[model samples]
Target: MDKFNRKSIVLLVGLALLLALPPITIAMEEAYFISLFSRIMIYALAAVSLDLILGYAGMASLGHGAFLGVGAYAVGILAFHVTEETAIPFLPGGWAGSINAVISWGSAIVVSSLFALVIGALSLRTSGVYFIMITLAFAQMLFFFFVSLTTYGGEDGINLDQRSQIPGLDLADDASFYYVCLALLLAFVYICYRIVNSRFGMVMRGCKQNETRMRALGYSTYRYKLICFVIAGAGAGLAGALIANQSEFVGPGLMHWTRSGEVMIMVILGGMGTIFGPIFGAVALLLMEEVLAAYTEHWMIILGPVLIFVVLFARRGIYGFLTGDGGRDG
Candidate 1:
């Protein structure tokens, strides 16, 4: 088989194994694994979204976690009104009596996209460290805004009384929710693959490679970057919505700069610009954290050195190393 086919088969096998995890955990009577993997999948989704802008488009956004928090709060705030049987405060409509997962998720994406557009439009004018600092500042602003909103529990955060209703699925069930997250992750991966291979993706990459040349050729790199940023924000919002449901809570902490750093780390550690790399990174980092935490309280002390070693030696990250694609093109 060709290299492409071999790689495809490997990815398929890995996905198959992930799909089997719920049943395997059930058989072993280890229910916590389901929750753990579900959380991993959610973070993986966020990381994948970050990879699109950071890896493919060469936009080093340091506040990507803000989108996640926006999505979660969108769902949380909507559900809060639903439970309270009151109209959304500041909206023109009547009480949003029944909370629907579909609507909630859609709202999350829309809200995050809007936020991304505002941030990207401003930040894209700058480059390098300026862009990173501006994005981080915007994210911090939102974090504090949410923290000061005492109605939503402020620093204490808000909790859902129940998972949003999705026609027939029992989202409250851990296994079912895990499957939902996994399905979304697969779909997001496929969508991102298509986007990365399309004409728009080509232009975005060209701008990344040589922005001056692209501008000289009459291409507006700013617009392209802004659109890509919005797309990534929408994806992160979806992940955040799922995470809110999974944990049955939402808070400003989701948008914290540290959380954004974590997702960025996942992208770099997995293999920046590689579509499937972030997923591998998420699994590896989270799993290592779990294992190391079990052995020591200062798990990061050990993990930090190991990560540095990988960066120096592996270069391509675990996925790239394994696939022999070291992300040189990326």
Candidate 2:
């Protein structure tokens, strides 16, 4: 009970700080942090989505970054057509590009979900290290595929002329965009929290704990995991769209296996299976990179030991340590 209270307090205060960041940064004339923290929240959204599978469902997907790439591409390609005043040749009805956030970002979520569907369908057939390798292989396949698209700048990637339009909102304003990202993050976190507490979440976690037992009980663990994978992919897709808008660019690097590894690190470092923990992990890891990069080029050398210390001693990660709770969701 005490631990729950502490966790609740920390989460509330953390959210409050996020809410107040724009004013705080503006007052200090550190307005650049608005963009930086916006990027952090976008990655946080991706990390939380990864935690859905890696933490609760025990799925180690090394290719999850592919979904983000696919999503960003959706935005890029559509905007490309709009910029060039051309329609996609392959599709009938002369479908052209659109800067509409609803069309572009919605397509991102849908297309990414479909990508996850195909990937999860095949990937879930294996487990253990084989699963990891297959996911990595798929991610590499996608990375190279995007690199080959010379029209999208090949390895150089594509750039957006403007941010996606949101109804009555100026995404061009850093503070406005930050709040939108914050609102979306809160919404998705709430969704994940409900999911991890629901019957489906129970089955998913049970599969993680003892798949054999779940199968013996007549539960089709594959189906549950696949659904969870799709859900996570959708969340990641949204993050990708935000990334494209935030950076005004989308590159093949988004699909790189190393990117997936970074997101995985955020999940584990934040506290796997705890919905709110990865947010802190995202904040901590990114802030470390930002601050450390200022001091030296060899920031990663310093980061290695900090991560090692967290992994070795703070087993429950930053949030878990703060709240005195075990890392698991339940």
Candidate 3:
């Protein structure tokens, strides 16, 4: 009860701050923070998506970035075709492009979910280290595949002509986009919270604890996990689309295995198995980078030790620490 109260306090305070951040930054003449926090929220979304699988389902995926990249490419390619006034090569007829956020971003979610479906189907067959390695390998495959697309700028990446269009709002405005990202993040977090508390969530946790026991109970753990994996991929895809809008660019680097490692680090730093933990992790890690990088290029030297300390001592991560939770997971 005490822990719940503490967590509630933190959540309330955090939400209030986020809600007021744009105006606060404008008043302080630090409007740049709006953009920075926007990026942070985007990554927080991605981290939360990963937590769905890694935390509750015990599926540690290293190819998660592949979904992110696929989603971004979905947006980028669509915008590119529209801007160039050319039909998409693979599609029949005059399926040119779309600037609609709903269509383009929806494409991102659908395509990424499909990709995750295929990858999860194959990769989930293995367990433990093999699963980790296979994910990493698939991510690498995607990274190189994107790199080879010379038309899309390949290793150099491609630029977005403009932000996705939403009716009654101009996403080109930093503040507007920031709020959109925040809204999506909050919604995704809520959805994850509901999932974690549902019967499906219980089954996921059971599989995480003992797959054999879950199977003996007539649970098709594989199907449940696959569904969970697809849902996570869809969320990550949304994050990727947001990131493309935030940066106004997309590239193969988005799918790199190293990026996956960074996100996993964020999850670990925040608190695995806790839906809200990764958001705190993203904020902490990114802000640490922003502040420390301004001081020196060797910020990693400082960050390395900080992460080591967190992993060594506060194993449950920043959220766990703040909430006074003593358990290892969530």
| Candidates ranked, most accurate by lDDT first | 3, 2, 1
Task: Write one digit per residue (lDDT tens) for candidate 3, span 68-104.
Answer: 8999999999998998889989778889989899999
lDDT at residue 289 of model 3 (Cα atoms): 90
- Among these predictions, the greatest lDDT belongs to 3
For model 2, residues 1-330, the per-residue Cα lDDT tens digits are 877789889999999999999999999999999999999999999999999998899999998899989899999989888998999776699999799999999999999999999899899999989999998898899999999989888999998899999899999999999999999999999999999899999999998999999999999999999999999999999999999999999999999999999898888788888888899999998999999999998998987887888888887788788888865543
What is candidate 1's lDDT per residue for 1-330, written digit by digit as tens?
Answer: 466776787688889989999999999999899999999999999999999998889899999999999999999999988888878776776756346988999899999999999989999999989999999999999999999999888998889999877899999899999999999999999999999889999888887788899899999899999999999999999999998998999999999999999998888788788879899999988998899999998998987887897778876677777777654653
| Sequence-dependent TM-score of model 2 | 0.98
lDDT of 3: 0.93
**Clashing pairs in model 3, backbone N/Cα/C closer than 3 A:** none
Ranking 1 against 3 by TM-score, winner: 3
lDDT: which is higher, 1 or 3? 3
- Give candidate 1's root-mean-square deviation (CA, Å): 1.3
> Going through the candidates in order, what is the number of backbone clashes in each?
0, 0, 0
* Weakest lDDT window of 10 consecutive positions for candidate 3: 321-330
